[model samples]
Target: MIELNWEGVYPAVLTPFKENGDIDFEMFAKNTEAQIKAGVHGIIIAGSLGDAAVLEMDEKFELLTFTIKVVNGRVPVILNIAENTTKNAVNFAVKAKQLGADGLMLLPPMRYKADDREAVEYFKAVANATDLPILIYNNPVDYPVFVSLAMFEELQLCPTIKAVKESTRDLTNITRMKNRFRDRYKILAGVDTISLEALAVGADGWVFGLVDAFPKETVAMYNHVKNGEFAKALELYRWFMPLLELDIHPKLIQYIKLAATAEGISTPYLRAPRLPLVGEEAERINKVIADGIASRPKLD
Candidate 1:
């Protein structure tokens, strides 16, 4: 089993598509390289921001394989498992390990809204099926299930379940988890808007969305906070807040891809049933991206 440090900024990378809806491995490689160049601690492929819900199983594996090749062990390449059934999740976890993934970002059973016990069982079932280190994604606001601190107590029994992506959007939970677990589990801030605040309170890392586009600033902000340069971190955070707010929006895929496109790292194309942003919506989001680019902070 490869040990993942599971700290620092890890991007829930977006899957870029060509206009005809094909996975653009070239663009994907470019984006992965950009993340590596910006010094991200890890790369999470097939995540929510990656549009995993719409991706075919084969497509997911291909993306995973390609990312592992691109990263080439410079940093961990964690796969995201967001399946609706325990059987499917377990199968994916097994395949992920076989395919050379360093770790996993596991979500609760998707769409069905499993309760706490079922959610815990679902996680444990997958954990028991594979030796990969798991980071339980607990985002009740976006995802239907919420893994509370009490539930985490149950999860601790499964040593493979090693970390928590704390996306409940409650800053207090950071302190609560730290106070209770005290390093038993790594607590990563999953919500982008409150990441700096979460870090201040004691988040071990950030599982971020906008880092797909603003990697340098995102990474610099995390490094600043981790190094206790709060003033510099805040300066970057205040400038980044407007753009960071885009990550929480429903159209986050389009928003973040636009930011990446603005940086020349990604194309703005999205897979269908999802369409491109247009009209006032496009203009509005473009302004946010534009303002962000115009005033991007210079870090040393």
Candidate 2:
């Protein structure tokens, strides 16, 4: 199993697409380069922010392979597994390791809303199938099943499950997890809006969304907080709140892609049933992105 310190900012990357709906590998590489250049600790592909549900299995593998090549080990590349069944999840986990994924952000059974036993068993089954380290994604606000701390007590028995992407959105859970487990699990702040607070309260890392577009600002915030420059971090965070709030919207993929486009990193092409933002929505989001770029903070 690969040893990951699992510390620092890891962006849940946006999957860039062409106008005709094909995966835009060129733009994808450009986006990856921006993250690497900004000194992000790692990158996550095929995540909720990346529109993983709409991607086919082959596309997922292709993105993972392509990302590894583009990254070239400059930073660790983690894949998100959103499978609905234990069997398929295990198969994908095995394949991800074989295809050179550094680690995984594993989600609970999709659509079924697995009970505590089923969720625990599902996670254990995947852990047993692979040697890859796992960050169990615990986002109850968006995903139906929430992996509670008690469930994590059971998961601790699985040695490879190393981290938690804590997007439960309750700030106290950060304190609760640390108080309960100590350093047993690395806690990554998964939601963007409250990320500074998460870092202030002792999250080990951030699994970010808007960082897909604003890598430098994201990395700056984390670095400031880590370096005990709380005032600097707060200054950036206050400026960053409007853009960070985009991560929580239902159409975040479109909104974030547009934000990236505004910054000249990625194009705003989304796969269907998901459409491009238009009219009032487009103008509104564009203004937010434009205003953010215009007033982007200058850090020293």
Candidate 3:
């Protein structure tokens, strides 16, 4: 298959839930349409931002299938197929290819945390499972047992590992990996807060949940960075700091959904064991979102 270019703004599509806490497939489609209409580069379905861990395999397949059908090849649809086991991740990777997914954004296994070599073998196994390309989701905060900089460099040399979302605050690692494997791998800025900086240091682009709430603003920010308008991008990125801060949290799905509800697009419902934000928690989050919106730069 052709090499994947996960370059530019890709929104981690949210899994919309109805009032009864069921998957609102219709709303999910509408929201996806909105992103496409707004000119996002690609769509990442069933990610952490989509609350994928709680979703059943059937639900994940349905969402991926629906996304591919609706997107209709207008833009690439990359599935976020992640699990703790190599077998499960490999199975999902195989399924994603069958559904015609363009690529994958994979999170490292979190439970009990595996050792370094075991982790490397996990990704290599997934890569070998299917012809579909993979992008490492380097979210160290949530998945504490992250791939080391050495391991990432090693994966970069592997042909099937197409891209990487470098979430670590250590810009050093990004620079190191890019210097060594810039020709083979695309380094996507996984942290919204550091997109501009990462972009400056040779990052290809971003796989962002921030784009979920403010597509135009996020697009503008990336464009500004691309155009070397550091001052303007910095201005915009700071204006978006509140939403940026929420991204590193494990409950980003909850607050982001609430923010969407405040935007009147969807309700803030979440699946079992993962409660929706409420009371003072939601009140505080609402304030941040409202404040950000108030200060958000004009879209048009």
Question: 1-300 in candidate 2: lDDT tens per residue?
Answer: 335888999999999999988999999999999998999998899999998989999999999999998888788989999999899999999999999999999999999989999999999999999989999999988998889989999999999999999999999999999999999999999999999999889999999999999999999999999999999999999999999999998999999999998888898888889998889988898888899999999978
Query: After superposing candidate 3, which stretches have Cα over 4 Å from the reference?
Result: 1-3
Model 1 whole-model lDDT (C-alpha atoms) = 0.91
Candidates 1 and 3 compared by TM-score, better number: 1
Task: Check candidate 3 and list the clashing pairs.
Answer: none
In candidate 3 the C-alpha lDDT for residue 111 amounts to 80
How accurate locally, in lDDT, is each candidate? 0.91, 0.93, 0.80
Instruction: Look at candidate 2 and tell me the lDDT of residue 10.
Output: 91
User: Candidate 2: where is the Cα deviation over 4 Å?
Assistant: none
Looking at candidate 1, what is the lDDT of residue 182?
96
| Span of 10 residues, lowest total lDDT, candidate 3 | 1-10
Q: If the candidates were sorted by their lDDT against the true structure, best first, what order would they fall in?
A: 2, 1, 3
Number of colliding residue pairs in model 3: 0
The Cα error of candidate 1 at residue 165, in Å, is 0.6
Q: Cα miss at 35, model 3 (Å)?
A: 1.4
Per-residue lDDT, model 1, residue 93, is: 96
